[model samples]
Target: MRVTIDEDKCCGYAACLSVAEKVFDLAADNIAAVLVEHPQGELADQAREAAAACPTSAIILLDDTE
Candidate 1:
């Protein structure tokens, strides 16, 4: 899976980081950043969980087909 973050929608809540530290992290500006663009296995699942945990829905997930 592919992961991204909408900077405009991010509130620096860090919920994504909390859910998946290996896949997500806070940037220098405190916004959520994708640590791994293409995560697999357990990391993929964590990325999905992080996306759902995002209160502002800033996290974006895409399938490989796209």
Candidate 2:
């Protein structure tokens, strides 16, 4: 999966960080950022949850596991 975050849509809710700190983090601008381009195993699961937890829907998951 390809995790992408739209900083503009981020509200600094830190939901992503709470769920997937290893995959997502706050940038210098205080917006959500994808730390890992693609996560696997449990990290992947958390990433998806993080994306869903985003109030602004800043997180976008692009599945490339075909």
Candidate 3:
């Protein structure tokens, strides 16, 4: 899967980091960033959870099939 974050919509909540540290992290600007654009297996599941945990819905997840 492909993971991305809408920087404009991120509020620096760090929720994504909490859910998927390997896939997401806070940038110097405190916005959520995709550390691993493409994740697999457990990481992919974590990415999905991170997207759901995002209060602002800033995380965007695109399946490879798409």
Task: Give the best candidate by lDDT.
Answer: 1
Give the TM-score of each candidate: 0.94, 0.90, 0.93
Query: Per-residue lDDT of 1-66 in model 1, one digit per residue for the tens?
Result: 789899999999988888899998898998888889999999999999988889999999998788
Model 1 root mean square deviation, Cα atoms: 0.8
Q: Write the per-residue lDDT of candidate 3 for residues 1-66, one digit (tens) a residue.
A: 888888889999998888899998798999987889999999999999999999999999987777
lDDT of 2 by residue, 8-55 (tens): 799888989988899988988888878898899999999989988889
Ranking by lDDT: 1, 3, 2
Note the clash tally of each candidate. Answer: 0, 0, 0
Clashes of 3: 0
* 10 residues in a row with least lDDT, candidate 2: 57-66
Query: In candidate 3, which residue ranges exceed 4 Å CA deviation?
Result: none
Q: Show model 2 residue runs off by greater than 4 Å.
A: none
Q: What lDDT does each candidate get?
A: 0.91, 0.88, 0.90
Instruction: Point out where model 1 deviates above 4 Å.
Output: none
After best superposition, candidate 2 residue 29: deviation in angstroms? 0.4
Which of the numbered candidates is closest to the native, going by highest TM-score? 1
